[model samples]
Target: MKDAKNVTITDSEWMVMRAIWTIGHATSRELIDAMNELEGWSASTTKTLLHRLIQKQAVAQHGGSRPFTYKPVVGEKESMAAAADDLFDHMCAMRAGSTIAGVIQSRELSRADIANLQAILAEKAKTAPEEVQCNCLPGDQTC
Candidate 1:
């Protein structure tokens, strides 16, 4: 897959990706079965989504048999982090902390998830500069 900001995955595509990510590698038949069990998607529907994913370079196909196996070309963490960065960039810098706090309050985070977030924050704190610079161009409204 391309950089997280450039990767535009639909909700349906995310479902198929999650299945492949969880399963490591899977045949089209296996993908259909897993997606059907997970999202009640029909085989034809799953196949179509799989094809789209391949075209997007989000998935890689392998095996020389009748039913080719597929695996994710992009890692889940990379995708999520890129998407989160894209989202965070849209908000005002001054409200970033409050926005993140609001998100934390809204979600039911697991203990592990909380721990991971804490660890990431701690690491960032250690290396964070005194001031962050804005790289926006003259006509960019996002800044």
Candidate 2:
């Protein structure tokens, strides 16, 4: 299995990955049907996406029969974290806190999730810098 941080999954591919992760393992027909139902994708379109995933080594094909099983080669949680990190890396560092706050405000988090976040923030508060510098360009340009 390839590490999630090393693989770059596109948005469409992420949709397919979500389905595969939710299903655990499935055949092409199963994926085709799921994609069709969820995204109104054609069988060929799903097949193409599957082929691309296979090429990227993010998914694997198994069994010797006509209807082979496909499983994720990358983990869902790890992939999501990596994607989030990638997104944050492109944004101004100073805005990350407020951006994260916006996401937390918009998303429905469980009690445990909120607790974990609070713990993490409490720990970070000890050594966190007073100000975060913007890194949008060379030197000290702000976004």
Candidate 3:
């Protein structure tokens, strides 16, 4: 299994990964149908994407016979976290809190999710700095 942090998934590939992650394990036909229905992708397009994922070692093929089963070699949660981290890494560090706030406001989070976030925030607040430094520039300039 490939480590999610080490793998870089494209947006289109993330869609395929979502399907595979949801299904747990699936056949090529199953993936093709799902992609067609969800994204209106052609069978060849799905196949090509699958091939690329396999080469990346983010997915693995199983069974000896035809219609082999495919499963994710990378974990869904880990992949999502890695992707989020990658996005934040590119942005100014000072904007991360506001960006996170925007994301939290935009999404429909469950009560449990909210509570978990609250707990995390409470813990973090104890040691939280008064200000976040901007990393977008070489010196003290802010973005």
Candidate 4:
């Protein structure tokens, strides 16, 4: 499996990954059927996406039969975290707290969700460094 930071799953690829993740593992024909049923995509389209995913090391291919079964190389949580980090990294790090607060306030979180978020935040706060280093890109002004 490639490092999480190196994996880039496009929106279309995510759909295929989601199906494979939900099923735990699936063959090409099974994946094509599932994707077709869900999004009306052709077999070739699904195959192309699967091939790209495999090339990117986002999906693991298992052998031992005529048709191989595929599974997500990266778990959902890891993928989500990497995607989220990418989004935040493009924004101003200095305003990250405000940005996160705004997003939280925008969402209608359930009680359990709120509790879980609170616990996660508390744990993260405890381990957070006193000073964060800025490694923004040269052309970027939102450091």
Task: State which candidate has the highest TM-score.
Answer: 3
Clashing pairs in 1: none
| Residue-level error in angstroms, candidate 4, position 29 | 2.0
Name the better of 1 and 4 by lDDT: 4
Q: Which lDDT values do the candidates have, in the order given? A: 0.84, 0.94, 0.94, 0.88
* CA lDDT for candidate 3: 0.94
Ten residues in a row with the worst lDDT in model 4?
133-142
Assess the local accuracy of residue 6 in candidate 2 as a C-alpha lDDT between 0 and 100: 89
Per-residue alpha-carbon lDDT of model 1 for 31-142, expressed as tens digits?
9998899889899999999999889888988988777999898888888887788778876665577789999999999999999999999999999876554445445444
Residue 87, model 4: lDDT of 91
The C-alpha TM-scores of every prediction are: 0.75, 0.94, 0.95, 0.75
Give one digit per residue, the lDDT tens place, for model 2 in 1-143: 68999889998999899999999999999999999999999999999999999999999999999899999999999999999999999998989999999999999999999999999999999999999888888886776
lDDT, candidate 4, at 136: 69
Error of 4 at 31 (Å): 1.3
Model 3 C-alpha lDDT per residue in residues 31-139, reported as the tens digit of each score: 9999999999999999999999999899999999988999999999999999999999999899999999999999999999999999999999999999998898798
